[model samples]
Target: MHGLPQAEPTNATIRPGAAARRSPGWRISRRVRIGLASLIGTFALWWLLTDITGVIGPHRFPAPAEFWAAFVQIAIDGYAGGTLITQAWYSTRLVIMGFLVAIATGVPLGLLMGVSHRAEALLNPAFLLVRPIPPLAWIPLAIVWLGLGDAAKILVIWFAAFVPSVINTWTGVRGVDRTLIAAARVHGAGELRLLWEVIIPGSLPMMFTGLRLSLQASWTTLVAAELVGAFFGLGRVLDAAYRDINPPMIAVAMLAVGVLGALTTRLVAVAERRLIPWRS
Candidate 1:
């Protein structure tokens, strides 16, 4: 016993405090729980209104259970010429394709107009002249010019998304701090370097705002474009529902749009948070 090492203390086996520190804090976890509870409560209220109380007839409004049932049935059995997911993909592809093209061209052109006098002189007036026209009004003209294919729909969405992209991007670039630009120049940063290092980062916040707006525009325009003549899309489903006066199908499409919009907006917020550490 004299030479034996003492046994390690059993008290040192673990630290509950350390584990607690790694877990979420009360405020954040509580807020998340509350938000989820509120969402479920809203759905529950709708269910009660239609099903239990019958104050709202099921014909006029499907219960939550019935709506979800219809959703699943459409997803599996195929509605509006294809399954719900299939239709969603058709709409989503159109939105993303047109939205991407709009931002790709619009943001760069906007930045150029903001920074270059010649570009602004040449492009600004025409842009100002055309931008105020309603996005949906382009649908008929696009169909005539591009034909009633995906190209026409894409053109419509592009017009809808492009305006917001250019306007916001221009605002961001034009609002860049002149002092920062001057400082970059004084520090021996060249024209390219000044733009890359000073202007772009400063303008990212506004550009991100534009992206959110473009997202909304893309969705709204896609729905309109689809209504004109689409083989498969939520808008087409809504069109049918309108004709049939099918409340359940209408509710499904409406809910789908709301959910998609919320999720995408949340994703953009997350991306902004991660990408722009300076903001936080």
Candidate 2:
């Protein structure tokens, strides 16, 4: 019998037309991989310098292993008048509340400013002046007006987040192409319809960028806000650690704040991609 060569298993050959796409969950983006690797490398360097080699003393900077051990205990046992979870939750909740408020107020004002000269004239001077002032500068006034409570903390976070949101939203709208507007009008789009369908969509990328900036501001200023009148939070933990000279506790709080900030930012980024798939 003449034997014809059997072809390699059909599945082994790559298909000719388009490559198969991976589902979102199945794909880890390159940036995430690089960032994780960088974190690990940085930790390795930190461990070698502080824990293993003893180039830096634990008294000054807790060794990575030391920090890990303490962190485990912190998770189980409450410290500095609040459990670790309580501290984190308090700060995270405040950030969420304040950030949403900022977005709600800022985006509209920004859009109005972009499209209306009257709105810009009314708001611009105050905005420009306030924008440059440090958000923390209001702490003394906040304590006097709102006291050391949720109000003061929320106000601080709000101020921190508001600037970036307004700025970015304004930038996004102002940067919109007038030509695009004209095209939409030629197609009989009404002013309100065009504003919603054209301007808002076009400005989303910038709006999202602003939102991220606001989110960062919200969290970063959280500690400063908590410093005034907080019973429990990372900020309180930090203050206690400073007074007690506890480097490990300081490191733990810092790490938690940073990791939580990263996670929140990632969540917002996912929303950005979903809400504006065209940007992708």
| Most accurate candidate by TM-score | 2
TM-scores of the models, in the given order?
0.87, 0.87
Candidate 2: how large is its RMSD? 6.5
**lDDT of each model, Cα atoms only?**
0.83, 0.85
Q: 1-280, model 2: which lDDT tens digit per residue?
A: 2263323445235642222233355557878988899989999999899968999998999997788876876688867887889889988888899899889999999899987889999999999889998988877788898887878888888888989999999999999999999999999999899999999998999999999999999988888777555777888888887788989988999998998899999999999989998755
In the predicted model 2, the residue pairs found to clash are none
Which candidate's lDDT is highest? 2
- Candidate 2 segments whose C-alpha is farther than 4 A from its true place: 1-36
